[model samples]
Target: MNEREVLSNYVYQIVASLVASGVEQVVVSPGSRSTPLAYAFASTKELTLHRQVDERAAGFYALGLAKATAKPVVLLCTSGTAGANYYPAIVEAKYARVPLIVLTADRPHELREVGAPQTINQVRLYGENVKWSAEFPIPDEAPQTLPYIERHTVRAVTIATTAPFGPVHLNIPFREPLVIDFKTQLQRVSFVKSFTNDLTPSKQTLAEFTSIIEQTKNGIIIVGELPLGTDTKALWNFVRELKWPVMIESLSNLRTEVPEDCQVFAITTYDALMKNERFKRNVRPQTVIRFGAQPISKFLMQFIAQSNPLHYIVIDEDPMFRDSTHSSTHFIHALPGEWLSEIEISHVETELAYIEFWKTADLLAADAIAKYGQTANDEGAYVQLMLESLHEGTDIFVSSSMPIRDIDTFLPVLNNDIQVFANRGTNGIDGVTSTALGFSNGRANRKTYLLIGDLAFLHDANAFVASRYQDCDLTVIVLNNDGGGIFSYLPQAKVEAHYEELFGTPTALAFEQVATMYDMEYVKVTSKEQFLATITSEKQQSLKLIEVFTNREENVKEHRALWTRINEVIEQWLDML
Candidate 1:
């Protein structure tokens, strides 16, 4: 067989193996070196190929797809810096435990060190960011090479999707004359059977954990950012069965639609209520069973760090360490869903006052925050109003920093069905729009909206060039605060000398023109009522951008004032105690 035949056969089997391993989506960024890989992936009938011009956006695009579908999505890019562009997404995927298969096409081995054009040391380009990285041997005419390629490709998918799931890199170095026979058929496609094992805690482990739970009524449960489609019902059932008040962060979709009777058990306002120093110091629990990644609230983390619960058990499906407080006394190696559904956690009812104490405090904080939002006009009320009015079953992708924090504070607890997503893994603001766009693309039928800030929206302006969302229903609510609104809440705001130029990096871009350039309908949101009426009136099938102007300093003052009011409510309750 000639070079074209060998290349076609090898690439065909690679794509074929990926398909057999349950990969239905492939995100490809075009380049010359990756011709063979791109052509083969495009040729495959079973795979839905998504093309993105920006490698960075493409990587996160795949990340969002993997996140939404809960499956491994393949990412293909060219050699050199094209592979490097995937670093941010890989970091997020690794830390977030999203499954992604990264494939970077490189020059042949001899051309790597010799500085061939478009060639660099693509081997281990992503380094430890990926779960596995391999330098694939150049395509060969030998019959045995087919089996090696097939098995290696399959193994990559398995490693990425397994527990502690993450991205995997396969660097393919191709010689001159990249494969051109797009119609070349595969000699053989083989698939090996594989099974997964759930890391369930043993009887002794569960008994010991349950013993701690039964020992005290003041036990707490914290469920952080879990992967999409986790068995939230089972986890909620498990928490409620224990009768322990649970703190579910915004990223954890389980916080929605809590029954009226069970609403008291859901602690959704720790960010505001924990602001009261007295409540923070007084409301100490005996045990803290945390599931999934670290909770997003800084106040909550500080509370846990200072309070020092007796037994801090971190229950996670991933074996990786996510104990942000670093005070975990027990580490249960079990998925929250699997353990909650599989194991029988005995009903350990607590003193009526214990649950009522938390219930009252939560109700007070929520009421105070809601009342403040009624009169306040800032990013908080903007986010609060929009989220509250979202159509049920809307998938809203939230950006990092102030947007998520505000949502954390103002997110309505009962009868809410909106699923929130964010790139909180590494928590960098880059690619915020792209990930949301990919998420929109993944669930195209669902009414999707992106809640982003000014800087984050501009940071990924390149995201539009790489996406085909011009026709998609992606309602982007760009909060044009002019700068980093979250920075105003930090102490650096006191550094009047350099805060504006340094921390307050504002992008005063005309988003009306930006929307036009990006093929989106621009709507300037003037009032909360107009905004609510616009979003809820009629749903459009095209991309829409709703721009809301705000002041950075005003947003901070608004949030602090609301927290102050919530603290007042909290302290009044404590005074009665």
Candidate 2:
């Protein structure tokens, strides 16, 4: 067989194997070294290929896609720094438990450390962020490296798609003999099942956990971030029926059936209460029931530590350190849905006044949210309006910093069906745009919205270069307070003007320039009126950039003013009683 035929067959075999192994979306970054692999992925009809120029953005884009789909996303890049560019997303995938399969093409070992163009250490470049890492040797016609490639690809994808799922690395070192023909038929191989089957906990494990829950009173259930399709409704019903003081994280998806009696504090909102003596004493339950991923709050962590609950039950399939509560008593290695079904709801006695205490606190919070709504310029009001305008089942990828916090605090989820995602594990602004783009890959049938900040969007501007979201009805609403709006609410802002220059770091880039560059539909709104009008408008074929402009300093003042008013109202209401 000709050399091109051999390589083409190799390509066909690789792509077919990936498709058979359940890899759906493959993100390909353009480069000469990766031409064969790119063509292989794009040529196949079974797989979807999202073409991106910037490798860094492409990597995060794949991360976002995998996160939303709960499937393994394949990332293809050429030799050199292209592979290195994926490191950040790889770290996020590992920490966030998203499945990412990285395929990096490299020159043979002979080309390494010898002034070779676009070449570096491709071996284990991702550090501890990858679940598994392997390098495929140069294929020789006789006993070809096809078997090795197939085995590693299968294992990497399997590990990434299973529980505690994470990113995996595969480096293919090819020589001059790497060229392939288009028409050659490559030999195929069966995909090996590499999933971990020990997900079912033993009977003894269930009994031990049941004993803890039965004996514990004054317990609190803290649900953090959960995986997609993990059956949150069943868990929500169980917690509600149990009448436990459950602290629901925004990403937990446990906010759907929240009871109106108000034992649930909406802890993400009243962050300042963590420091208040009366607030802590009144709201801190004796135990905590944690059942999701890590939350986005340092104040809550401190509160958990200081309040020091008697016990904290973290029920999750994966045993991860969910928080710094420093009091995880029971790590139930079973799915929340599984565990909740076995236990029946029962009445437990604590400080009997605890329920009423939280009830008063919830009323205080509701009143504060209502009053804060009057000021349409603040972060809370912005979140309220944005969420109210969105429809059910809209996939929203929230940027980590302030946008997520504000949503957690002020926005009442209009629809429980609206899927929400964020790079919460790393919580960095970089690649947020790319991540959203990656998530738009297979969503031609659905609408995807991105709630981001001005700075975060600017951080990954290159992501909009060539978007595949044109058919996906994608919209990006950028809250342009010009900088880190959330930082103004932090203690650093109290230090004076230095806060603006050092921490907030406001910028004045026009969103129109970016929209024009991408040939996307754009709208700039300076008030709530324009925002609502644009949000309610019909969805378009092109991606839409809705920029809401506000002053950073003023936004901060507004947030602080709202908090002060909340404290005052809560105090006066208590006095009336």
Candidate 3:
């Protein structure tokens, strides 16, 4: 076979293997070295190709697709800094455990150490961020080469979608002749498929856990960030049976559409109440059962430390130690769904005083917060309005930093089925827009909403250039606080000398101009009624942006005063204990 035929078969076999392994969608960024793969992907009818210009946005776009589908989505980019642009998304996919197959085309071995243009050390570039990385052999006619290509492609998909799914890398090197022959169809070879078996706990394990539950009366369950589309029926039944004080994180997808009876035990206001010196000192859990990752609240983390449960159990199917407190006494390596569905539970007879106390404190804190969020014209107030305005079965993607923190504190348990998503893996603010846009492609995307900070919006505007959202009914609500609003709450705010120049680095850009540049309908919400009306109104455009301007200083003061008020209310309640 000639060079053209060799490259054609290699690329075609790789694409077929990806399909065989269950990659339904692939996002591609045009580049010279990746032309062969792009053509192969575009030519195949089994795969869907999304052409994007910016590699950074393209990377995050793939991440969002993987998240929405709960399957492995392939990402293809050229060598050099283009692949490096994918680093942030790769890191997020690592922590978030989204399965992404990154295929980066690189220069051949001859170009290395010669400082070739558009070339860098492409081998294992993502480092520890990926679960596994493989460097493909150059296109050749060696008998073993084709088999290796076929098996490795399937293997990459298996590793990516296996237990604790995450990103995987495949660096393909191509020489000057990057084009493929169009005369003959590329060879599509067959490969083996991969499957992941569910891990269920044994009867002895279940009995032991039951004993732990029966012995302890004041146990608590902490549900953190769960995977998207996790069937929570089993989890809900477990929570219902336990009737423990469950702290539901914003991304857990547990609080949305929860039963009113279950919501009584859900202490969503713990972030506000945990800050109280007396509450933290007095309230304690004798046993703690944690599921998923750690919650995004530092105050809650501190409270967990203060609570200091003696019989703590963390559950996961992988080797990861999900307990950040390092105080957990047991780790169960079983899938949450599998064990939660199979476990047998019989409630132990005890007084309902422990959970009753939490129910009262939670009500007081929630009342105080609702009053503050009523008409304060603060960011939290805007967020509260936005959360309430979302329709049932809608998807809301929140950005990190202040946006997520606000959602965590201000959002109350709702009966509507509103799914919440965030990039809290690394908690970076870089690709909030692209991830949301990517998520907006699958089911129920026509009513997708994004609650983002102003800086995150400006930083990721490149995602709009080549994005072709299928339904495109995306409503972006930007909290335009000018600069980093979260920084004002930290101790660094006291360093007023360089705070404005350094931390308070405001970008005074008229977002209306940005809306004009992107051809999106722009509306600046001024009053509380106007903001609520704008978000709840009919959707006429493909993409509409609503910017609510706020003050950095005032937001800090507003958040503190609300917390103080909550503390006062909770303190009064805790005095009886």
Best by lDDT: 3
> Candidate 2 has what TM-score?
0.92
Error of 3 at 360 (Å): 1.4
Give the TM-score ranking, best first: 1, 3, 2
Ranking by lDDT: 3, 1, 2
What TM-score does prediction 3 earn? 0.95
In model 1, where do residues sit more than 4 Å from their true spots?
342-349, 468-471, 539-541
Q: Residues 277-390, candidate 3: write the lDDT tens digits.
A: 876665688888888888998888777776778788887756785767777888777667846756666666434988887888889998898788664778988888888777
Off by over 4 Å in 3: 182-189, 346-350, 444-446, 468-472, 575-577
lDDT string, candidate 2, 1-99, tens digits = 666766776677677778778888888888877878877776677787787788888888888788778889899999999999888888888888888
What is candidate 1's lDDT per residue for 402-497, written digit by digit as tens? Answer: 888877777868575788889998998999888887788788778888999989988887787754633345888998988888888788988899
What TM-score against the true fold does each predicted structure earn?
A: 0.97, 0.92, 0.95
Every candidate's lDDT: 0.82, 0.74, 0.84
| RMSD vs true structure, all candidates | 1.7, 2.6, 2.0
Question: Which scores higher on TM-score, 1 or 3?
Answer: 1
Shift in Å, residue 161, candidate 1? 0.2
